[model samples]
Target: MTCTTAVLLPGTGSDEVFVRAAFAGPLREAGIALTAPAPPPDGTALIEGYLAAFEATAAGVDGKLLVGGVSLGAHLAVEWALRHPERCSGLLLALPAWNGVPDGAPASVAARISADMVERDGLADALRIATDGVAPWLAAELNRAWPRHAAGLAAGLRAAGAHPAPTLDALAQLRVPVGIAACTDDPVHPVAVANAWAAALPRAHVRETTLAALGEDRAALGRAAIEAWQQASASQGSD
Candidate 1:
């Protein structure tokens, strides 16, 4: 399928600003227009809001869409695609946190912890606690995005922490090509999870990068996912 447009979403407490920075250039170079929607402020409705946005965006397009995103965003994209397979061309999943249920996964645990902190200590204090001991680039990203979430930050984190990603069995049903990206050095989003996703998906490839590379250039993650997608697409075409 020819996909000229991509609708990418952001991770927990993240906004379209980060999504655009990560994917806009790479997608532009690939001649694909990108729509990075701003997530709704109400955390309770995040999943539904994201799905609605995807549907609305796809409605305006002529052909199937390249749908995906980072972390929780990636999970939600898969959920949407599973429901509307014909509308999806492929996936560009980055930093998949876990398979099946959250099940106290590292990412889920951290999200829950962060949510608790945000609720008890407020955004500024929670951010300090969350960013502490993290890489400067990551800290900077949280500082930039977290405040925008403000009052809804805790709810959003809790909602994401509780949400389950597509299970391995469900992934097997998705015949579309997928490109998964994993950060080799990032513990929050384990590479093992990405590998599991690749193993379950019918036509999927994984490209590994490091958090340091992503820190130096936001496009590093996007490039990894796109490269993996390209490989999957080539393999699918060959078959």
Candidate 2:
């Protein structure tokens, strides 16, 4: 039997540990083989690095491929899937950060990072503060793996900074089935943005869950996302 495969990409300042904690266990229970690739600690070239890693891992595969990510990763997944709709069997996007204000309109981690860079001794401290507040499960992983994770953060920051917010016009054209799982009150990924993406994608299905339901708890979120994918895949097969 050919194994169904998926690539789970994490958000900015997040690494494999974080993504694994959020996806691995639950997806395994659901019988999906997902690989969470590690991100460089510095996050400087995260998007390109992640895309390259994904391509490398998927080499020689000829079965259905699912690609998904959280926040900035989600945006990248959507962008890549749009470019290769024939390759992507489905998409799972959670908490897209693409709809937020630009680099200087507050809520802009990009602006904060840039401003902090101006200080000789403040950037490191700021980066610590910015990345430390992740979920405890993730914090434990980050503590165990700092340097490697830091490189990913640097690359992710660069990716997020350079990525432009996706428009409905662009998303509406994608034919690949999509599943959007959103947090109700996440400022970084507002409910409105998720709703918009769901509405825009031609074959998009949406599910709304809370942070409390997902925090440090991968089972709830992963199961929900997987079930959505199963349903979408089933529906697509039926039609």
Candidate 3:
């Protein structure tokens, strides 16, 4: 339950800078040293790339690690923890976008749609269309990440869409505590996904967040995850 070291990964197209801003504050408060590494670039083996990244990071750590991430990164976090339960002390799954499998998952669907657009009209058009109606911060992030890795990110989404994600049966058997956070107003990462995860995991907690608040303070996402983990740990202890 004492998580001194942790590794965090960013979502598709995200770099280390984005993940650090999202995780630094809360992890520091918890006295947990965090290393947010950028996942491998878009490749044929997108999932495997992330899985390997998790393995490599945990291998370098001296003690049990708290692993967590956002969206696709979150998916990889749970998948890795399930495989090497001994290495994972806790999980902070923020904005879980897929459940059971990636087939027809909303997040993957959106990613694929974006990919198709980029492939058809090119990155500039895709970025302009995406950031048009969104908030400045959200638009800025989309502009920053999407253009940087448009092609690879699109390919990564296709691979992720074909992934057979963790099922409820698998989640029920998770050995480490879990904290699932979600933005209620976010369509891509639905709140229902987080709720389902919390209900299925034997020791999972949910922290409902809002898109507006998340836009205002990116660290709020990390705060929600850390607080939910603490709550889940407390409830398990009381039992």
Candidate 4:
């Protein structure tokens, strides 16, 4: 049986391949249609760009539309949901970053590095730093696609640092339910941010799981995320 359509947005410097691994199989198995945009190169315009992409996608699909993302993707999802709560059915947020730029946020450093990359080495240097110690396959892929990846991260970092503090007062008005999944081992997307989102969104249900629980395997993350999505969606149906 087909379920509602859901859009999955990748994090900073991430491509469709990475996000597809994380969500496509699971979402497809769950009978959810998936839509994802290529990451924009300009860090500053990232969220607005994503919002526009989502708007275009939402226009094409019928019925309830669930929006989700990882890291910067999650941030953009939340921002969009805030603006058009009625248009969204629910949210599947994974690895959300800071509520806003906190002191010593890595985004600050990333932004600086991003500015430098556009001029000389391009994304080569930043891509090395962004994916250096990540999963080997992921790192290798980023190494090959460094320029495009770098530009997206540069734009995301600019967006992250400049994004205003998210207020729940607007989110509090949302009738759409939310599911937030956090990776305990993630340094970039902290658990605190997930907890904050849970507290802020009146209908948000949060699950804090370890990377090990989700496994290094992408399928594992997708499975765990689906479980959370089920619980959140079920609750919404009940309400």
lDDT (C-alpha, whole model) for all candidates? 0.91, 0.65, 0.81, 0.69
lDDT tens string, model 1, 141-216?
A: 9999988876778888888989999999999999889999999999999999999999999999999999999899
Q: 126-226, model 3: which lDDT tens digit per residue?
A: 88987788988888888887756645767876776666667878888885778878998898888988998888899989998887987899998888988
RMSD of 1: 1.2
Number of the top-ranking candidate, with lDDT as the measure: 1
Question: Sorted by lDDT, highest first, which candidate order results?
Answer: 1, 3, 4, 2
Q: Between prediction 3 and prediction 4, which has the larger lDDT?
A: 3
Provide the TM-score for each candidate, comma-separated. 0.97, 0.80, 0.94, 0.83
List residue ranges in candidate 2 displaced over 4 A.
1-3, 99-111, 114-124, 131-147, 151-155, 235-239
Candidate 2 lDDT, tens digit per residue, 1-239?
12477887876655677667777886777677887787744456666787776676667578656888777667777777777766677887877765533444222465346334424335456546645666665455444554455434444554566666567788888776677787775666677877888788777777778776766465555566666656655676511
lDDT of 4 by residue, 89-195 (tens): 77788877666554555544554565566445556565666676677766765665445655355556556556654555655666667778887787766788778
Candidate 3 stretches greater than 4 Å from native: none
Candidate 1: regions farther than 4 A off: none
Error at 45, model 4, angstroms: 3.0
